[model samples]
Target chain A: MPPDMPTEPIRRRIALTDDGPILVHGPIEVVLTDGKTMISDRAVTALCTCLRSSRYPICDTSHRRRVRNVTARGSGSGMDRGGRGC
Target chain B: MLSSTSPRPVTAPALPAPRGPLSSAVLAALRGISAAPHAAEIPPGAVGQADPYGEDLQLALYCCYELHYRGFAGVSDDLEWDPGLLGLRRQLEQVFLAALGADVAGGTDVAAEIGALLVEPVDAAGVSHHLRHAGQLWQLREYVVQRSLYHLKEADPQAWVIPRLSGPAKVALVSVEHDEYGSGNPDRMHARLFADMMTELGLCAEYGAYLDAAQATALAEVNFMSLCGLHRRLRGGLIGQLVTAELTSSPASDRLVRAMRRLGCGPRAIEFYAEHIEADAVHEQLIRHGVIAPLLAAEPELARDVVFGIQASTLLADRFADLLLSRWAQGRTTLRNPLPELSHRR
Candidate 1:
C-alpha cells in the first residue's frame, strides 16, 4: 500500500449512534463499522465534535481521539497556568 | 463572493423578494429602481413584529448589509456607496443595535467576560450537541449548510478592522487572520474548507446559494459581524466578535469533529472541523493574551466598546442557537427549504 493509503483499508463510516456530534471529511469510499459507506466527489469537510462516532465523519466507528496533548502536557496544573502546558 | 486572487470579480446574489413595506423599499433601491430611502414612509417602529429577531427586519437589514459584502448580482457595484442605501442601513442598524444593547447587560471586566466564555455550559444544547448524540448525517449536513453563510466568508468581517487597529493589537489580530486565510495556501483557507465541505455534502458549492433559504435568525448573526466590521467606530466590537468566536470555537469544533465521525462522514468533511479543534485552541489563547489584552493595554478607553462587542455577539449567537433548536424540536426544517428536497434537487 502507498504511504497515504491505509495499511489495511481500515473500514470507516460517519454515523451518530446516539445524539453525539462527530463529522469527518477526507477521501470518499470510507466505510463505517455500522456497515454504512459515504461515497463522495469533492474532498474535505467538518466532522462531529462529539465522541460517539460509528464510522466517524464517514458511520459508526465510535473512535475518540481526545486532544490529550493539552491534558497530557498540562497534567495537575491549575487554570492560571493550565494553558502553559506545565 | 469576489476573490482577490480571481480576475473574474465575485458578484453578489440578486435581491430577495420583499417580505413587507420595509423590505419592499429596500429591495427596490438594491435593484436600482429607487433613488432615495423611505424616510417619509418609515414603518412605524411599533408596527414591526415585537421579535427583535424578526424575519422582516433582519432580512431587510441583511439585504442592506449584503451590499457591503457582495452586492446584488445585477446591482451596480456603486450602489455599495449610495447615500440612500447607507441611510436605510443606519435606520435598521439603530433599531437592531438598540435591541441588542438592551438585551445584553453591560460589563466592565473584559478578562472576566473572556473567562466566562471559555467555560461552556455543562448542559449546553446546540446543533453540535445534537450531532454528538443521535444527530443524523442529514441533520449534520443541514447544520453545515446553515453555517456556510458565515464560514464561506470567514475572516472578512474582522478584516474590516485591519485599518482600525494599530500596534501589537493590530499585529496580533492579523497573525490570526493570516491563518484563517490559509496562511498563504488558498486551499487551506477556512472559507475554502467550508466550501469543500458544502460540496462534499452534495450541496451547491456556489457562494450565497443558501441566502434565500437562510432565515432572519441566521442572517442577522452575520450582519452583526458586518455592522461591527465596517464601522471604524465599532472596531472594538469587531475584536469582541472575533474574541468571542475564537474563544468558543475550540470546544465547539471538538464537538463538531466527533459529530461528523459518529455519522460516518469522510475525511474531507472532517478536515474543516479538525483544523478548528486545534487552530482555535491556540486562537483562544492568542485572542485572550495576544489580541485583547494588548489591544486594551494600548487603548484603555476602548474597554467599554470591547465589552459591548462581546455582549452583542453573545446576544446574536444565543438568538441564532435558540431559533435552530426550537425549529428542530418542532420536527420542522430549520431552513426555509427542507434539506430532503435539496438532496433531490441534484
Candidate 2:
C-alpha cells in the first residue's frame, strides 16, 4: 500500500434520472455481455438505460422524447434508430 | 504547463473591422485614437436609438466584452478597466438586456422550461436539421465560421458563474467545465478541438479569425452568454443558459457528426461534434440533477432569471439559425465576408 492511500473501502454512488441515463460516479470499467470492457474516466458517467444509444453502454441522450409533429425525419432524431426491435 | 515549443501560442487576435458608428467608436476607443462615450456625455436618445439587436449595437457590445477576454492585439491590456470603456459597456448591456427582457416570455418554472427543451418536435427547422438533411459543404463551412466565434472560446463565458455559486452546484458545474477543458489534457480541450476542426475544414483556426466574417446574429448569441455570466445577479440565468446548451447539444452534435460525414469531411473535422454527442449527454444529466437541483434549492428566488436566461438564449439561437437557413435557402453566404475555397491538402 502507498503511504498516502486511504485505509477504508470507498463506496461508489449511482444516480437515476426520471427519464434519462443512470449516473455513476466514475473512473469506472464496465464488462459487456461479450466480455469486452468499456471505461469512462469522467467525474460522473451517464450509463445508457434506454438501449437506444448508438454508443452502447454510454448515454448519447437517445432517451429524450421525440415529439412526432410531422412525417419528416428531423435533426432531433438520434444517431441510430435501427435499435428499434419492432 | 505549456512548453515553449507549443504549436499554438497565445497571441491576441487583431481588431476586427467596425460595422457601424457604435462599433467604430468602441474600436477607436480601444485603439486609443479617441475616447469612448461617457454615459453623461452621450445624447439623450443616442444609445437607445441604435437597433438593439442590429449590426452596430451587437458588434459594439461584442468589442466591449472582448476586452474582458483575449483583447485585441494592439489594444492596451490596461484599457480593460478603463472607466470610459466600462461606462460604454454598461450602456450597451442595458440596451441589449432591455431588448431581451422585452422579447423573452419570462417565467420561474425551471423544471417545466427544461422539460420543454428536452422534447424535440419532428417539424424542427433548425440549422442542425437543415445540415442533417440537405446541406452542402459550403453551407457547413459557413456554419463553422459563424460558430467559430463562440466555439473558439467554448465554456469560457460560463466560467464567470463559478464564484457566484456554492456547495454541490458549484462542484457539479466545475466538473462539467473540467470535461470541457479536456479533463486535464490540454490537447483535448474543447476550444483546441474546435480549432482543430476549423483547420481540418480548411478554415483559419486562429482565435477570433472569423470575427470580420460573422454576422450580428452570431455575435448576439455569444454576447448573451457574456451578459448573463458577467453579472452576478444573473447567475441563475447563466446556469439556465448553460443547461439549455447541454440539453440540446447532444442530438444536434449527433446531427453535425452525420453532416460532416455526409460532406466527406475527415475524422478530425468530425471529431469535435462526435465528442459532443456523448460528452453533452453526460453534461445534460450533471447540469439538471447535480447543479440546477442544488443551486435552485438554495437560491429559489433566482428562478425567474434562470428562465429568462434559457428563453433569451433560445431566442438568440433561433435568430442565428433563421439567418443561416434563410441565407442558405437563397444560395447566399451567411457571413459578412465569404469564405475562401477549401484547400485540398489531405
Best by DockQ: 2
Q: Which tens-of-lDDT digit does each residue in B1-346 have in candidate 1?
A: 2445653246566667776777777787777677656555555663244355777777777787777787678888787777777777787788888888887767667876665665545455665666677676666666777777788888888888998888887776776787788766677788888877777777766678777778787787788889998889888888887877776676666677888888777888888887776556545545666678888888888887888887777676666677666766776677776764465221
What does candidate 1 score in Cα RMSD to the true structure?
11.6
**Interface C-alpha RMSD after superposing true interface residues, each candidate, one decimal:** 12.3, 8.7
DockQ of each: 0.03, 0.25
Give the C-alpha miss distance for residue B266 in model 1, angstroms: 1.5
Question: What local lDDT does model 1 show for residue B103?
Answer: 76
Worst 10 residues of 1 chain A by lDDT: A77-86
True contacts kept of each: 0.00, 0.28
Q: What is the TM-score of chain B alone in each candidate?
A: 0.92, 0.96
